[model samples]
Target: MSELITIIASLIALLSALYARWTWSEAQKANKISRLNMLLALKQHYSELMLKEHEKARAWGKDDSYAEACRNSYADYQIKYRETSKELENFHARIVADNI
Candidate 1:
């Protein structure tokens, strides 16, 4: 009876280990998916901002107050877009490294 109890305990331990491993793997997969989604969102946001900045630039000139404001806003958006792009590149590199 003692031997049987020991065997059962061992089996239970093995099952628990497997369950933990599976759970960990699933969590990793979820994290990867979440990161990918964030990357996509950042890209989309940067693209939209860039397009709007371009539109503002094209409509710029005339030395009017509104034009000046638009230009300033465009410059700010340009800086932000560049920073976001750099972040996206770094994130992509990290994800690639993780896969390797």
Candidate 2:
């Protein structure tokens, strides 16, 4: 009877350990997916910003003042860069907090 009880307890422990391992593996996979999604979003934003800059430059006429064009481009890039940086920082903080 004792041997039977020991076998049953050992089986249960083994099952529990397997379940824990599986859960950890799934969590790792989910983390990787989330990071990938974040990376894609960042890339998309960067591409969009670059496209807008390209369009702005293309729209400029030969008569357009060089100084003004340079100033506007710099200002626009700075604003967009700061906004995206803040957003990413907030997103990262949230993810870290949730994971913790």
Candidate 3:
């Protein structure tokens, strides 16, 4: 009877270990997904804010001695604004696709 009880205890311990392993694996996978979501959100937000700032900069031109420099600076902001807007759109599309 004592030997039988020991065998049962051993089996129970093995099952418990397996259960713990499965739970841990699931939790690790969830953590990775959560981290990816956070990174995506951060990227989207940062890019959007940068685009907004660039737009504002173009609206409010800098005071410069050289007219050519002023036009060049405004042109730079215009280019960055368009690029950032495109990037944000691409990222937004990706996030929507990921959700689907």
Candidate 4:
């Protein structure tokens, strides 16, 4: 009877360990999914913000008075803005690719 009890206890312990490992793996997967969702949300938010800013800049560029205010400055801003937009796109793409 004692030997049978010991064997049962060992089996229970083994089962518990396996269950724990499976739960941990599931938790890690959940964590990864949440992380990806967060990244996607962030990317969408940034894209919207960038679009808003681009529209504002475009409006300013189109306005005769604003364009007349500082043509050189506006030109420089447009160049830098486009470059920054490209960089942000590349960065976000890389992040998503690497994570996935």
Candidate 5:
């Protein structure tokens, strides 16, 4: 009877451990997926901003006087886009590294 109880206890422990690990893995996967989605959205936004900035640059290039102002604005936007892009890259790298 003692041996049977011990065997049952061991099985229960093993099942508990497996449940914990499975829950943890699922949470981790969800978090990583969320991050990846956020990164993708940011990338899309960055692309749109770049497209707008390029259009502004092209328009201003056709006019000598407005060139400087347009260039400066585009520069600022470029900096912002770059920072966001860097963050996205970091998120993607982390997800990949964790095999998520």
Candidate 6:
């Protein structure tokens, strides 16, 4: 009867160890999923900000009065503005591609 009791106790210990290991694995997976969701939300927020910037830049480009003022105030303003806008657009495109 003592030998039988010892065997049962050993089996119970083994089962407990396995259950703990499985629970730990599940927790790790849940943490990874939560982290991934947060990263995706952050990326989406950044994308929205970039889009807003792009719209603002385009609006500035469309305003003839603003362009004239810039041109008069700075000789290379138009060139610089166009270049910067292009760079921003390229960066936005890259971000969109990465998300996809």
TM-score of 6: 0.53
lDDT of 5 at 52: 79
Model 1 lDDT per residue over 48-76, tens place: 87778667766775667777777778777
Give candidates' CA RMSD values in order: 2.4, 6.2, 6.2, 6.3, 3.6, 10.1
Ranking by TM-score: 1, 5, 4, 3, 2, 6
Candidate achieving the largest TM-score: 1
Model 6, residue 100: what's the lDDT? 30
* Every candidate's lDDT: 0.80, 0.72, 0.66, 0.66, 0.81, 0.62
The prediction achieving the highest lDDT against the true structure is: 5
lDDT of 4 by residue, 2-27 (tens): 99999999999999999999999888
Q: CA lDDT of 19 in candidate 2?
A: 100
lDDT of 5 at 75: 77
lDDT of 3 by residue, 1-100 (tens): 9999999999999999999999998886676567556656655665566566556656667654454454566566566656656666675576567663
Q: Per-residue lDDT for 1-100 in model 6, tens only?
A: 9999999999999999999999998886666556555555555555555555555556687757665554454434444445555655565565556553
RMSD in angstroms between candidate 6 and the native structure over all alpha carbons: 10.1
Q: What is the lDDT for 64 in model 3?
A: 43
Clashing pairs in 5: none
Candidate 3 Cα outliers beyond 4 Å, as residue runs? 61-100
**Of candidates 5 and 3, the better by lDDT:** 5
**Preferred candidate (lDDT higher): 1 or 3:** 1
Give me the displacement of residue 52 in model 6, in angstroms. Answer: 2.3
User: Candidate 2: where are CA atoms >4 Å away?
Assistant: 60-100
How large an RMSD does model 3 have?
A: 6.2
